[model samples]
Target chain A: MSVELVDVAGLDLEAEADRVSARIDDFFTSLLQPPGDSRDQLYAAMRHAAIGGGKRLRPLLTLAAARLFGIDEDQALRIAAAIEAIHVYSLIHDDLPSMDDDDLRRGKPTVHKAFSEATAVLAGDSLHALAFEILAHEATHRDPHVRSELVLELSRASGPNGMAGGQMMDLAAEGQPLDLDAVTRLQQLKTGALIEYAVEAPCIVTRLARDARTPYRGYARNIGLAFQITDDLIDFAGDEAAAGKRTGKDAGKGKATFVSLVGPDRARQQARVLVEQAIDHLSDHGEEADMLRAIARFAIERDR
Target chain B: MSVELVDVAGLDLEAEADRVSARIDDFFTSLLQPPGDSRDQLYAAMRHAAIGGGKRLRPLLTLAAARLFGIDEDQALRIAAAIEAIHVYSLIHDDLPSMDDDDLRRGKPTVHKAFSEATAVLAGDSLHALAFEILAHEATHRDPHVRSELVLELSRASGPNGMAGGQMMDLAAEGQPLDLDAVTRLQQLKTGALIEYAVEAPCIVTRLARDARTPYRGYARNIGLAFQITDDLIDFAGDEAAAGKRTGKDAGKGKATFVSLVGPDRARQQARVLVEQAIDHLSDHGEEADMLRAIARFAIERDR
Candidate 1:
């Protein structure tokens, strides 16, 4: 519940990339303090998934977006924490035996592997609840409209029409023949929705009208695809240690992906093009958007 | 989503229990119209779990409470649907192979039996997200503060410190020597929290302060315990055909429940006492509280 009152104006995104994980970890560490007794293990699983590792890309995107608009640091960070919580929840659920069946994530045992499957499911469910809890808090924004809107947008982005919908498509399409458009739509929901929310959330906080949000949303959509392409590329051809998960999963499951459909070389080229397009969408902004631009590049550049 | 506006005030609780299912079914039917293609199965599973049966006790509680305050019928039903969505979601997840492993719910095939386990999980998660989405909607209430608080309360009720936490304790307590107090605490979270929210949501919509909610909270707590005790009694002695879900799972699992701790006669007597206490807490109100009083009695008297 403690908010670190950092000077968002003074923080440099490029410089803070290394520190972002620690900051987010600290945020989650304080945010997820167990209420003790029999439920302590639930909190422990949540902490293991939430506080320990990962690049914190989604939250960093939220912070970078908030910085672009000079939004209140506390508001931005709480929103960031909410976004990151959703991302982490999705990862935990995705790693479930009924889903991706992964044994590892962030180079450690997945939630289901480390905890009982029932505990992992409950942990993920609890974190999903916590995301809304954060967004609905008065501290997230003084304006009730902003808080409500944050809850609305976050829920929509993560719900059936968004991330959950995308995951459903992904599950249904497994081992089945799928075209490029199908995969694109699937990824757009599973990964794209949350990423778009990460960027657009600050806009919601600022109450920027939807008509005026084209550039920001375009940037989000493009980077989202770019990020997914890079992910597929890594899975298709990257070191297991570097990626910190079971790579070649798409191929192992005989599912078509960006890499499989377009081929690795063309997929990489598409990702580069998408990242460039993402940057282009932000051309209307000045140096304030530099962090967002760097993140777009990082979408393709990150080995994991 | 289409909102079916019922004149909650004119509706009689004792007479309406039979009608509540059809009304809630219509609401969920319209609410969960799945966009076509691969994701349709997810929605189908959601509809399968949400639409068909069950007593609709929780949402009925919300509607009854809303009647007390003359809140908008649409707003009331929307909130009711949100509460019901959370309830149905919990049931779906609870029946998963990893959890209670039940094959039947509402006298029909469980979600996982009707669909793949992955789809069931996603469907449950989607319903969970949909609950917040409904609460955060502008139509739920004109006041954003009301909406935000509802989100906060419901999330808190359903989150780690509430329903999920309770479920965790329930899982851990299986085959363990759980005392009466521990069983009470576990049930308080697993089932009581959401029920408490059901009675309090209208208070939130009306912006009733916490200090003013003592009687209401007391009423909720008592009825919640009464309802659970009745449920345990049913599980201990009632027919599975009448209960919808499998009976005797509590003793079958060797977990201590209200009936396990207290003799069935004492459990029944205690439930009746709690119901009286619940009705007594609402003594400050007049005829408007009659429905709630009816519900309290029904809590102890219903066979199911």
Candidate 2:
């Protein structure tokens, strides 16, 4: 039984996703290589890694969260772009031979596999630095303190204690018997932290009214965890063609995924519970929360 | 003949280097993982790549410049540490299989060779991000505009048109004939950019009186270029043991170098001229410029 948001029209969802995607595309285009630069190869590698595929879920969450707080979309776009940059950088490095060693990501050859490993590594490093640079540049992000906070949040989420740390845990536990709790903790840091940062950065930047910030944090945390759970579920049941990735690879690797620990049926239930908790926090905002609610449910139920 | 600055006593140079080194050690220590964190492996890789060996040349120049302008050493320490972090990150990524493919650095196994490639990549990426994060957090850099400038300068130095671009050029030009102009441009982007940033940042951060900032920029550019040329000379003449790297590797790789484009004797002559030009920029300043003068000469004249 897949859950879907009944009130929001399907066309609106597509439009919102497209809108977020366009904004992100434009952001990368603008900040990524100015004219007359001789470093075309490096810029090409960066663009190759950033553009072409993957749902702009993190940036969309950032925009939606800001919209719920009544912040202007223009004001939120840089922060959104910064989140996606960091996310893309992680994916690039994660695909390297020394890491997950995956040949394909989002239906394309992974960065290191497609380009040379040196370019891929440098591309990831440059993109990671670019995220903060884009955020810190006054022309892009005007408020110094807000820019500072954005850098801090992105760094914390991307660094060892966050996504990188989660990756290390995932690497160490590849063939180990991790319990459900260990799996959850790993996912929370690996995937959840960045998602949480995406949802909360705009609020932190805008200095949302204190009362509004508190509940939104709760809303973000739940959805972030829910997103990871659904991601794992998809990996478990997803078709290789539709998913654009090799399915069931996790089990072959002896990875301790949520489904591996608790079984798929229970994992699905936990995901739904998380979606419910995520939506509950936005009850006070009514229609303003509708898109977000739809997104949370959609994230779990989508085939790819 | 090797140029020397008689004004800067050896004791003073050692004292400043020691102070900067200690501060860097403290910064790395504070960044150590909390017990039970999943990032212990990644953190260890980063520490291993960063701690001990190598001349802290970039950071020393930063400290020396700040000192010349009467900025307190305490105020410059964070920025100095930040520069070293950037330099270390570049080295780790450069030595990876996809880039330089070197097996060793500073007489020890390269980070990727010592640890897993994934850890090396992540550690490099983390250190790059950490440099910006540390700079953004500088309490001393309270002016938003100045802080923004610092971020931009460092980013430009670290990004495509800077170190990354240089590495790409090196890759593209390997075993190919590169003219003197192309080689100089590449070195400027690769090595000179960071050295330039190292010198300019402290002055920018301190909001040095306009007159001082102008001369500092000129001095930095000359010293930066001179430093790279000197590096080529050392690679041509220095011993493997003294350089902490295999001597004559560049010649073996058929890589273009200043010494390759110009004869070794001519390269040495050019380096001396640049160093003299670098020192001349500080003529208006008194004894404070002595250390920088000594450093410029040392960069070119050192055996290693």
Candidate 3:
């Protein structure tokens, strides 16, 4: 649980999370640190938004997947950091007063609450741009084709038809009767899209063949939905302080969520089934994917 | 001035704008076409924000620059469309209640005013993603290096150090006195960054040498500043109806601008000088860059 390196292939979840978090910290520290004169305020706010907090779940997924391909750690970490930035930016925007209106995230004041709303918006927008910038950099991959594919895939997963499109659906579904199919589709686009991107990114980096990617995509699809269901379950029954954000807000707003749609027991049962299915897709990689298998289990089991 | 084809070398400025606008409209028309089921509203909102209603100046600059290298028109048009999407996304975000708080743009309701706030946010976010998606596509550039270059340059221009950074500076500058240098830096990052990107993107596509791009960069810098100066001038003197969006908001908010830092006549003269300098950089290409030259002149001379 301390800052020591864990056996990455082992099931030391806490140590692995710390490892990912350390990578994120080091990356942002250099990215934002400087003589930073005029832009100090902005750099500070961006740092605050991106640098610390979270379980580093998305980056962990990227790392685990990268390990599956024996990808270089530095290159994988860079991509993981970009994915973390995009996730954090989305969180920042979603917490804005005009959006979810949340005041807390990771048990601290949300970006807009800590900074100004204008700063929050710009910070989020900048992070989104920065994510693509990181992926496009030569440092991310030797192959420009790989770099380009990463950008293309990341944008598709995060953009209008994917992450952004899912968000649009979520907003529209609020207080409306969204059936299971609609909810599943919404979750796939909103949370699922980025999760899929994180898991599939290593495939893109290693230039996995089309057929070789199906298992990873399938693994991602199952876990993506499982992750959201667990999130909803946490919101349904867990403490807000432990969750690091508000809970029950969904029910407060009459938002259609898996837990609400299927009840807490059924939701928990469904998430377990998904975790197994998700792990099943990793069978192709055998023991090389143990970390990924560990993560799929962690998805539904983690309390926070 | 209608949607008729204009002489690319001549000064039929309005006709050229219309031509670019038509290209933009056609591109989005196909992009957001039917069979759009549950996400119809999102697609519709995206179309309304992107298609039609502007001078299409950014896209025109891109097209003009592309033509300088004899780049393929279809390829150039695709890049132009992506640039326009980025521009529109910025506008949509800027018009948000937490940002500029404008209700009008291009003589129509702003995205947030026409749609919901959440919808506007997602639409803008989606468009941002779409911009990168378009650029990273094989259709944008055959070379993966070129595609990565486009993504890198565009992201840098639009991200923290560029457009978003400029916006952060701007929001912080509101109700505060900003000197000429500060204002220049702000404008450079804000409006100038994207303008420079538009002018230089074709250079990336054509794989021009870094040193060979200096003239284009210089030209873009001058015209970018001129564009801002004229915009400030328009805010100072032009009618709101002609300007499309509310003008003089800078003055109303006690925000520093070119016109405010210098007198109106001085700002106008400065813009004129910049336009001359901008056009001078294109002397290397002669009449081959006439469209670019015409656009430079139009930047400072147009009523809007």
Candidate 4:
């Protein structure tokens, strides 16, 4: 079969993904290029960090969660953009030489490696501040309560006890033996925290049913963990070219990872179980949950 | 005057300053070591950057502003702490090799130079975020609208079009012939913005008269400009030991500064005018404004 024909079965997924990606691009474009400004280099750094990359998975989760509650796509877009900004900021900082020291990201040069470290730092800082600014500026979030909650939730997720805390834990755990529980907690904080925020943020604003939120949170938590585990497994087994990053680099650096702790087979098994749990959480939602489950499964099984 | 009288007067100032300093110190210590499992190294870096030696001018402005409105000193402490965090984050990022590239700040090693650049960036990021976090957490602000407004004001002052925009302008103007107007605009955004925030935040939270905010903003604007011009003059003529920084560095770098553009004598004259204007704004408020006016004069006239 032709390549197009082989991919045609997942057309709905592809179309939704494309729509989300375009929204993200528009968001970044609007954010980085404010009208009538001539700080070209700073904007360039911001654009370089934000545009033209990533799976848009964080934003997709945000949009998906909003949809489950009947939120219009437009309402979701602003927040979707904001979460992506936070996620992009994290990745930019993570790739700094003082941190992960990676030169490449998403098949391209990392922001720090591409721009100067100073620009990278500023760009990351600007992106982070911009995320809050974006949420605050959203005309749709007229309720002060909604705006405040969004700011609080995003800040909690992105700040010390969330992404930064997880990163610190990961840094502290380098070359150390981390059991399954420890690994899970670290992943939950570092990656899952933002994911949880992404899924829960729309619900927080819309005041969705607690019953609906509970399952979405459960599904997000499992998928978030599964996403990291599968990522670890991919780093162990996937081709560097296909992955757009150096495979086995994790082991080379003596970084404590799931694959290092439990072997690839068990890591894969864990991811499978998490994906199953994630899907099970959605059984009550009918067809609306199909994209979420599919995305979770894809997160676990994707080669890269 | 007799030596005994001199000692008594100086001691009063010293004791009051010490009391204020202790408040600043306690603020840092509490934030750095929050109760329970909340402490993290990023928080430590933030505390380190913020708590280190400085004149505590911004926090003092906050305290003074609150006191002028008859607000309790204790009630003002959190706002004082939050503004200081914003100030410190600006300084930390400013001292980065990419920005000001200063090795020393307030007689101590700068954050990025003292710690890893990555840590410095993260520390600045965390502190900036923490400022809003603390503001939002201020339960004493019974009105949610007040809390939201406080957050918005601080965010705007700290983000682009305020301090960040000023830094960009400063960077771009290096080695260029920036006119006096351009220099004032830069200083207003860079320094005046936060000073304005410091003075206005308390009033905003207390729901003080809308007219009350105008004078404070005027006072802060003039004082902020005076502060920068005095700083420029100090850089031109002050000694390194007393100034706590490398003397004459601004002119040496060919950066377009107030002193460099208008000459040191003119800069000093302009600073005097600004201080007078700053004091004039507080004419409506009585003795409480005296200390604030005294501070503006001290800011301009200090040799260091």
TM for every model, in the order presented, reads 0.93, 0.92, 0.93, 0.89
Local error of candidate 2 at A171, Å?
Answer: 1.4
* Local accuracy by lDDT, each model: 0.87, 0.78, 0.85, 0.76
Q: Compared with the true structure, what per-residue lDDT tens digits does model 4 show for residues B251-303?
A: 66667788877887788888899888887888888766655766676677666
Which tens-of-lDDT digit does each residue in B75-148 have in candidate 1? 88889999999999999999999999999997899999999899889999999999999999998888999999
Binned by DockQ into CAPRI classes (incorrect, acceptable, medium, high), candidate 4 is: acceptable
Candidate 1 DockQ vs. native: 0.80
The top-ranked prediction according to lDDT is 1
Q: For residues A1-304, what per-residue lDDT tens digits would candidate 3 score against the true structure?
A: 2223224434576778898899889998887773254566777778997888888888989998998889998999999988888888888888888788899898889888898787788888888999999999999998999999999999998887788778777777778858788899988988888988898999999999878899898999998888899998887776444556555878777788898789989999999999899888877676678777878877887776
Q: Native contacts retained per candidate?
A: 0.88, 0.50, 0.84, 0.25
Tell me the chain A TM-score of model 4. 0.90
TM-score, B chain alone, candidates in order: 0.92, 0.90, 0.92, 0.88
Displacement of residue B2 (Cα, Å) in model 3 is 26
Q: Write the per-residue lDDT of candidate 4 for residues A226-294, one digit (tens) a residue.
A: 889888887787644465665486767667688888888898898899988987888888667666766
Provide the lDDT at B235 for model 1.
79
Q: What is the DockQ of candidate 4?
A: 0.39
Residue pairs that clash (backbone atoms under 3 angstroms), model 2: A118-B98
Q: Residue A303 in model 1: shift from native, Å?
A: 2.7
**What TM-score should be assigned to candidate 3?**
0.93
lDDT for model 2, please.
0.78
Stretches of candidate 2 exceeding 4 Å from the true structure: A1-9, A33-38, A209-212, A239-247, B1-8, B138-145, B209-212, B238-247
Better of 2 and 4 by TM-score: 2
Worst 10 residues of 3 chain A by lDDT: A1-10
For candidate 3 chain B, the 10 contiguous residues with the lowest summed lDDT are: B1-10
RMSD of each: 5.9, 3.6, 4.4, 4.5
Over the stretch B111-217, how does candidate 2's per-residue lDDT look in tens digits? 88888887888788778867876777756476666666777778888877788777777877778858888888888888878888889988887777667677787
